[model samples]
Target chain A: MTVQARSLVQITAPRQTGPTLLDRMRRSSLLMAILAPLAILIVWECLTRVGLLDQRFFPAPSSIIVSLFALVESGRVFIDAAWTIGRMLVGFVFGAVPGIVFGIMLGLSPTVRAFLQPVIAALYPVPKIALFPLIMMIFGIGEASKWAIVAIAVFFQVFYSTLAGVVNIDRIYLDVASNFKATRWQLCRTIAIPGALPFIFTGCQLGIGMALVIVVIAENFGTQVGLGYLIWQSWQVFEVRDMFVYLLMVSLLGYGSQMAILRLQRAVIPWKKDDAG
Target chain B: MSSDPSTTLDRTGLSPPAFPKIRVRGLGKRFQVGKAWVEAIKAIDLDVQAGEFICIVGPSGCGKTTLLRILADLEAPTEGEVTIEQSDPSNPLSSMIFQESSILPWMSIRRNVAYGLELRGVPAAEIDKSVDRFLALTGLDRFADAYPHQLSGGMKQRASVARAFANNPEILLMDEPFAALDEQNKALLQEELLRIWSETRKTVIFITHSIDEALVLGDRVIVMSRRPGRLKTEFKIDFPRPRRVYDLKANPEFGRIGREIWTLLREEVVGP
Candidate 1:
């Protein structure tokens, strides 16, 4: 009969009376998230086959599959995909790690937060992509420049969410910890980290998306490898089908990664799932 | 002041078997509420015995829960202290059951019961043994792996009790643990509590506003005065054990004791 268990009892007791409209909507939304994409893909394949849409501008799913197979057989696509994934991993690590550390520092100390507020605020709105020329000038359009672009994008996105997470944890839990004679490090490890997990993971998800965007734009500026390079090169040579093939691959990779992260989240936070029900 | 239980119990033919395990001498508590100094408890003195089921009942604004919190060491008293002979201060020897149970939702039932042991740095082997024993004592063995969300209200409270007892604390502090449950669950829990208390023989200080609840579980009921709480009076029930509310209500002594408590409570509920 812990407090949490008692609360669950009270919460479910009142709501068990009816099949409310809100419950129906929640079930419907879950179904839609699963089914809507498949329906659209089917419609897309049909439209392209019947010549209702121009295949040059919008290649059929079958043609994209052929191009994907051709690229994979030549081994160029695997190397490019690996390079893109590797860059994302490196950039994500560089950006998210420092962003989380600094964010925690800022959240813990209002003085530090205040001191850095104006600097972050000024730079946050200036899109990092707009400074690609300056970055190229500084780093000379190598892997370093691409990684830096991705890192810069990731840092700001993660920093804000981490700060919000730390700042919003309930104060009462902290008070309870202190009363129980928890040491400073113990408090942070038990209370602070668990309290901030939901927010931090959210930031990671957002930052990963931003990192993908930067990788494309950064590779487009100058590079001989990566998914972004493939698309840029294909567009220039009138290989529209090849360009669409790269686009579809990148989309699938991004979507698949997000789904994997969500599954990891469920494993890590089973408590939230039970509570939601 | 008379140690002669014979006068109170001999005529009624039930001996007063319980003895006090903790003492409160001239106890008082004060707090600064905004700009003004507010007195929460005024020179309250009471005695609770080993294995004695005692309940402190008062109105909403009265410091009934506050008194229990002080005993639990969740808060320090501004004025006086409570003395428990067996309480080791070096190692925590008192476990509390809050109004809400307060079990960590993230933990499974077995882990929740093992929490106090973990806090005390008990060896893993011994903690596992003790958790298993108390889980059986509270009849939560079937729910060892279940999350808090999977339990019913009565079952959750049972888990909370198991958690408290698993610590092997000398005393247990319960602050309205069953107040939120429906009448059926509340009654069943009360009966289970009596059984557990008898088996474990741990001192219990229970706080509640329910008069019937106080009469049912308490060996000696201490009625407190409204706000600026003080010990109004105490009553020793001469009823026989294996006592349930239904059985107690049927006894002639139950009606007499119930009437006497109603009179004490009426004074506090009304004026003078």
Candidate 2:
């Protein structure tokens, strides 16, 4: 009976209601997002071909793509992308997981929050990039220093946001859960985590982006064989198209990870999407 | 519809009279707002027998909810003791339905109903049976997989009531569970509530601002004064079961009881 009713609804309903005018406009905007970058690349290529723009300074998209293809064929692009992504993941895990755990502990307990939040707030604004030189001085120009810099850069952002999320959860939900005889651990797992998930994810998203930016910059201080190293090496050699290729690689990598995180969020926390819709 | 109405009254008069399943003594509450301490409840006492349907009605800010919270152990009273004769404190003997849904938005309807059982370490098989039973009782089985956001206000309250009853609580404390619903839904839910209450026989302590609701649901309606809230008077209702909430208003007996309670309440509600 239930199956019959469900099928009836599905059969009667329009396949889509068709995309509204607003949806068409949004699709156009997405097209524009793609077109904007293409237009910039085409203009650069045209200027360079016409000798109005110097290929020596600004690289054309086609040239950059050729350089990118060469790097891919040599497996340099794939290896470098893998290495950078690995560093980012490890750094994010080290920084974000512990930061959130401690942040929530501090937020839930005033004494802990009072002791830690001040230290965090004070150190938060200081440019973590400044510590890159110090990290390299100690850890040397190995993977250790790169990973350390990325971890440190991501930590404070995720930590503070987690603290805010825990502190801001509606107290009434706590009261209701408490009255239901929910043990402390159950309350934290079922109520606290889900309640603060969106905020924590927000922090994670920002931290991941910031970590990439900081790690690449830190890598530039002294590095070999990553996207940042490739960019720096190409620029030093005045290989403009190669530098542009590495830069484009970094942007694509970051965009890919962001989409991955968003998809993960939707799967792990379907309720978040329901609340929004 | 028994030939002898009093025979079906279901009363067993015994020596101790089952110790009034729930007893409240010298209940009071105070909240500190910045520099000033505001008293929410003055000393008050009440007793609820097993299977008794009681409604506490008062104006807004009259501490009716605070009183319910005190009974539910959600709020510690400034000065009071609430004793439930046969219930365990470790596992809640009473479950409260708040003014809003409060069914934990993150949980599906089935999980929400099963929450108390889950807390008590009930096996998955048992939780499924109990949740299914209560969901059917409240006519919410159709929405077993739905989230609170997917439900209308009335449906949410039905889920809340089902969740509250899934544990077979000794008492149910409802704080205006239907005040937010439209009149039609409100009446329907009220009738549904009575049917569930009649079958389950759990003692109920409901707090509401609606006099009509009190007249319809309460076996005993306690009128409370405003501000430093106190019990002004009590009315014993002899209305029969399966009472439709709207039909009671047209019955002359309901008007007399309404006026009796209103007489005690009008001064507190209207000032002076």
Candidate 3:
């Protein structure tokens, strides 16, 4: 029935108000996304069954699914996923809030920006993960260390872009604010905050990605309940399927949270929604 | 050829107002461009009567904007004083309609129009009432909830006009408010503005490069010399009140006034 509809639409595309090929493809894009990986897995399963690949390193897709089910049934996925997400959220909130405030300050005052630009510029280029050891030593090798590393990483991402957003607001808007006899508080509320919101969101997207990268690495030590530690432990025990399961959790966290932030942005700053038209 | 304008208005004793609303004495402005000082306007002295519509016309880069900015208190004069008498203490000192669209992009047309009042902590009910009135007056009633990015250029300019008028400031400072509009929209907006101005009789100081625009809008046109912009001369626009732009343009007297101002402006920029 689907095939008949497809051919009929193709023959009389312009006349019919039916969904365009692109729209139809978009509906099936998720299926396409699933199909490609499923095809790869099927090829791998055949390769393994024929003994062309080693099961020791390259397990069959079916067996991997069995172990994935075992991991979920054992309740290992729930606890570890919670620990990792909690650390990221706590760190992100801490970093992003202060970063935005400081960014606004820098944007508002040229003198403040001038004095601090050198200090921030010198630190911005430093690999945040490189400071993990130093952070662990200072914050102690525990959840504090994990949270601290994530916060520091996310701070620069949010801070610089927030400053850029505020700085780049057209001068006329600021002039308009003053012409209305706006006080300092009114200026920030009316002009600075709204103007900087777009760049702040961009910074947050980058910050979240950075958080995912650093959180997994930070979990390598000083933590045992996160997906990062689960992946590392599975690798040590040669439980390849369990390792893949934990890796999937990390990917979902990254993808899900980015989409969540975008949703929130669309709601909170609805004025900056997708396009001018 | 139009005769040259006198270099000083005070010396010539032109149409002096009995009660000046704004008095400017030897006003000058200089900006530091990199290392050198670029004088924007020099030793400008003038007086504007209450309820007068004054237009400042000069060539491009002739500091017309700078003069308006100083009047609006957006910039400080380097060498002189500008004093605007407080005719109505309850009302705001001034509201400026910028060369660029000054309405905030994040705000809806209603909120943008109500901005000055909102900042002043006016009651929300009062804001809703006055804002709706101005929105209807400017024909932005339907677009009250629309964002600026969704509107056409002329419509955006209308939102600004609505905003400035709704604020009910004592003086209206406009810096080429219609410069970016096409001729048709400019004419329509000019007519709309005249209707609004006639109702309010607000003191307006407008800046423009077009002599025709000045003649169409101003009670008097002040001409300025090119860069280091000194006030070169003035012309009184005696055309009747509540004028229509098309009707005024069709009149032979209007073209003669525009050319008289234009020739004087050209001579001021080049030579006598």
Share of true Cα-Cα contacts across chains kept by each model: 0.12, 0.52, 0.58
Evaluated against the true structure, the overall lDDT of model 2 is 0.82
Q: What are the iRMS values of all candidates?
A: 3.1, 1.4, 1.2
Stronger candidate by TM-score (2 vs 3) = 3
Q: Output DockQ, candidate 2.
A: 0.43
Over 4 Å off, model 3: A1-23, A26-54, A273-277, B1-19, B269-272
* Candidate 1 lDDT tens digits, A1-277: 6455444433344545666887776779677687877888788899998989888888887787788788878989878988998888798889999888877878767899999978998999998898778878998888887888889899998899889988997764554454344566656665666667778888888988998888987888767899999989998998987898889879977877667667776787666644231
For candidate 3, the per-residue lDDT at A213 reads 90
Q: lDDT by residue for model 1 over B1-272, one digit each (tens)?
A: 01443221111112244534677777777889899988888888887766788888887778887787677666667766566655444445467887874665667899878876775578999999999998998889999999888888889899988887887777888889999999999988898888888888888988898878888888888888987999898988767788887888787777787788778888888977
What is the TM-score of candidate 2? 0.89
Q: What is candidate 3's DockQ?
A: 0.54
Docking class of 3: medium
Give me the displacement of residue B15 in model 2, in angstroms. Answer: 12
Would you list the C-alpha lDDT of every candidate in the order shown?
0.79, 0.82, 0.88
Ranking by DockQ: 3, 2, 1
Tell me how each candidate scores on DockQ against the true complex.
0.14, 0.43, 0.54
Q: Is the docking of candidate 1 incorrect, acceptable, medium or high quality?
A: incorrect
Residue A209 in model 2: lDDT: 96
Q: How far is candidate 3 from the true structure (C-alpha RMSD, Å)?
A: 8.1
Weakest 10 consecutive residues of candidate 2 chain B by summed lDDT: B6-15
Candidate 2 wrongly placed segments (more than 4 Å): A1-30, A137-140, A221-223, A273-277, B1-18, B87-91
TM-score between candidate 3 and the true structure: 0.90
| Pick by lDDT: 2 or 3, better one | 3
> What TM-score does the A-chain of candidate 1 achieve?
0.81
